[model samples]
Target: MSEKKSSLIPKSALTKAWLVWETFPQTCYNYERMMGQAVAQVFSCVIYYLYKNNPEKRKEAMKREIEFFNVHVEFGACIIGMAIALEEQKSEGKNIPGEFITNLKTSLMGPLAGMGDTIWQGVVIPILLAICIDLARSGNGNVWGAIIYTVLILAGAYALSYINFMFGYRAGSEAIMDFLEKGILNKLIKGASVMGCMVMGGLIVNYVSAVCGLEIVSSAQTYSIQTNFLDAVCPKILPLGATMLIYYLMSKKRWSSLKIIALIIVTGIVGGLTGILTY
Candidate 1:
């Protein structure tokens, strides 16, 4: 790519936009809208610039742009920059199809979210925070250590976000086309989904706790259901069963997360009160 083409958005404006997105993406998250409006707001300048002469087209574009969107904010900046570049080229009467952009965003968001969450939330932030918190809690009472660590984290995150945005804009539609042509995007999305499921399964088995309240009484001795049967069969049978039931509720019955959570909360409270669940 040429140097001029690489600088699609001016560096100043792009950096400012990245800061706004980083600071406020979650501020506008709603159940129905998620980050839809926040995303549209982030690229409002690009949208207006691209469709300035055509008010009707601008309205149409903005309308579609603010549809339900939810992605990890850090990596989502990349996709947003790519969208802006695509929109810019489209405004120039390029041969790009609208559905192509829409489908690309839809398909890429999940995988990108998984990758971003794994790197940032699952690993980096936690590890850094743990180490810094240890320093903060050290006997010296030096709050500056925590403050410096936080500033460094913020600076590093900003740099990463900027890099991702610029990379996406420079790569643009061609990169997406390459992924499609090679059939890699689908695999990426599927792999992320599978990995997310596996993680959830492991967490469920490792953390979910329950114990049997029943025991089999015999003439000679009493066989405890939890110690004798459950432990003998499988260690996490209750948790595994609970996880499977929730999965069935979601996959088969199409239950909403809120409803499922409510059900679990109620079940937990009642079970704890009734001594059915040993916790």
Candidate 2:
């Protein structure tokens, strides 16, 4: 292929966007990483746009563009950005630069994973659920409250994604560095962690401590012993104990998550059938 045609076709923004959208869903579980990838794509797109608009600024733009897409560890936007850059470099016959870019991208994956788990899964999801449930309960079981909360949660998620994407794309690498130095991301992560912990405490008291049936079965006499250990020692201990047991099994034993879920379901079914538990 001719050099001009090759450069034009290979490093286009459309191609980078397509790659990001396609890869994002597959790696959606890694929220931070995905965000990084998204940011990366934004960076690439911005660079591509700049190249088209002003060919003279290409080298200078490339030198400083990495910072615009820098995300707090879990932002998958970096991956997308790096991938696009790598592709462009390959097309332009710059193998060593492409490898260096790849290395930089790989280095950030771990930190991003941790941040994503703490922020998105731990804090944001729990807070949203807690608010929705609280509103629904307070509204005399009005379903609309729950619906509204759900919409808010979705809106928050999408808004964050869109803002990050735009910031990365428009400002290039400098925006990311600025966000980090200002400590905005750190504060947000910390806030989310606090909220998540609060929600978890509430959940433990409300959902985790419940026990439905406690009377023991007797065939010959009308004698019954309270089967609930919690009632004997302290009320609402069964759910807490169950929660601890599950936590221990999963964390200490390193059991598979799927297996733990199946065990919980099966145990519940058996307990209900044996009249030891009730809804």
- Stretches of candidate 2 off by over 4 Å are 1-24, 27-74, 78-96, 137-141, 169-195, 215-235, 269-279
Top TM-score model: 1
Models, CA RMSD each: 6.0, 8.8
Model 1 spans with C-alpha error above 4 angstroms: 1-8, 26-36, 44-72, 87-160, 217-219, 256-262, 265-276
Candidate 1 backbone collisions, by pair: none
Candidate 2 residues 87-118, lDDT tens each? 44444555435445545455444445456677
Candidate 2 has an lDDT of 0.56
lDDT of each: 0.74, 0.56
TM-score versus the correct structure, for each prediction: 0.64, 0.57
Q: Residue 164 in model 2: shift from native, Å?
A: 2.4
lDDT of 1 by residue, 1-279 (tens): 222162244666666666677777876689987888887777765665676679898887787777778888777777877777777777788787877777777877887787677666655665566567667877888796689788988887888887777767767856745655786656755675566666566666655787777767889999888888888998888888998999899999999999999999998888877767775
How much is 262 displaced in model 2, in angstroms? 4.0
